[model samples]
Target: MASKNLENFLALMAKVKGMDPTSDASLDIMQDYVTPDMEFVQPPSFPHGGVHGGRDGWRHMAKTLNENWQLHISPDHMWDIPEEDVVVLYVNMEWTAQKTGRTVHYPTMELLRFKDGRIARAEIFPQDTHAVLETLNAHD
Candidate 1:
């Protein structure tokens, strides 16, 4: 059986898949699963990189990325650490540049922390930042 937190996390991911990242509907979905003070951390080298605070901040990050790339994250494995209120996911991320139609595939590890059944923080670590950057800059 999955922990309640992990279950909620999975539910949240399901709701957001293929949804418009900048839409009000997406924000509405996030409200149900995320803490008001939810923090999202991404690599500073990436275009959408930064520490985003709160649900609104999360929306901003999502919107920023959505503007440039179509992203698909497929979870390869997941571990629920109930004692720590954490769920760790190993995922394959595919990013397609909207402008160039170039695609990059890479692995990433994500840590999601829960508070009162809602996600309070999410941190992403990508395996090949350079490859992703190259894809982002591709001309053809």
Candidate 2:
């Protein structure tokens, strides 16, 4: 069950990166994999910088992020918490700015909580946020 849940998340990210966010497939993936009340905690310095809730929030976040960069995520590690319905994932990601054509590769740690087999919450902690900001600023 844990592995399946993780795979769903992986697929979700893949769809987000590989297809247009507003496309039917992308929207369907989001609806099927994530709970309707799901929320994402994002760093203020990041491009999609806020607490985004629900499918609409997810769509808005995708829009904001796509406006800035195209993201490619590579999962490095994943572990399910023993006493809780949560998974911790470490990922290496590359974000290429759409406008400037500049890219930044960075690592991020995310805590995901699941409810009834659907993702309910996610909190992201990016390593070297300053470096990401610096790279984005340089291109701007």
Candidate 3:
């Protein structure tokens, strides 16, 4: 059985992916997974170019990324670091432009944390940032 945190994390991830193209994102779908003072950060490789501090901070970054490109993050694998309240996941992330049909595909590591059954924090470290960059520039 999945732990409460694990369940929340999975639900949150799914909800987030489902909304990227249409809505700001159903990120608050798993608000229960977050603390009143949650902090989420990312590495520079992400489309939004990384950010720091709080749930709203992450939301702003996500919105910024939506402006930069359409994000499609599909999971390839996941490893649970139970003791640390972390889930290290391998994912295939693609960025595509609707107008140009230009696309970038690559792999990345996502370090996710859960607190009180909510996704309290997360970060992404891309494995092939070059591929993503190349994709972004291909049509230009």
Candidate 4:
């Protein structure tokens, strides 16, 4: 059951990434996979850099990302900590700065806490914020 839940979460993420962020399909997937009170978090070096709540928060995050960069996210490794009901994922993230056309690639680790098969909280930690920032700033 845990494995199936993890697969569903990963599939939802992939489907969302492939579709237009504002599309009905994407919104539906977000609603299905994320809890209504879910908290989405990003590290300080991330563009938005804070805690965003619920599906609307995801929409805001998508808007910020679309406005600032083009991104590709790939899941690398995933494991579940049943005790905490958390799924830890290593993700490969690549993005191009829309403003400067500069590109950066980095590994991001994410902790996703789940409740009733939906993500209750998601947190992202990039391996090297300085490198990411430097690459984004290169063409400036």
Candidate achieving the largest lDDT:
1
Model 3 clashing residue pairs (backbone): 33-117, 33-118
Q: Each model's TM-score, in the order given? A: 0.89, 0.81, 0.78, 0.83
Give the backbone clash total of model 2.
0
Between candidates 3 and 4, the one scoring higher on lDDT is 4
Stretches off by above 4 angstroms in model 4 are 17-27, 138-140
lDDT of 4 by residue, 47-80 (tens): 7668988888877876776677777778889997
Local distance difference test values of all predictions, in order = 0.86, 0.78, 0.69, 0.78
Candidate 1 C-alpha lDDT tens digits along 1-140: 89999999888889988875446787788788889999999999888899999887888888888877877778889999989999999999898887778888988999999998898999999999877777767563
Model 3 residue 87 CA deviation (Å) reads: 1.2
Estimate, for each residue in 1-140, the C-alpha lDDT of model 3 and write its tens digit. Answer: 55666666777676676566324446556445577566666557655675556766767776766766777778889887667777888988887864455887888888888776666677778777666656656443
lDDT value, residue 5 of candidate 3 = 67
Highest TM-score scorer: 1
Residue 37 displacement in candidate 2 (angstroms): 0.6
Cα error of candidate 4 at position 67, Å: 1.1
- CA error at residue 123 for candidate 1, angstroms: 0.2
- The parts of candidate 1 lying over 4 Å away from their true place are 17-24
Ranking by lDDT: 1, 2, 4, 3
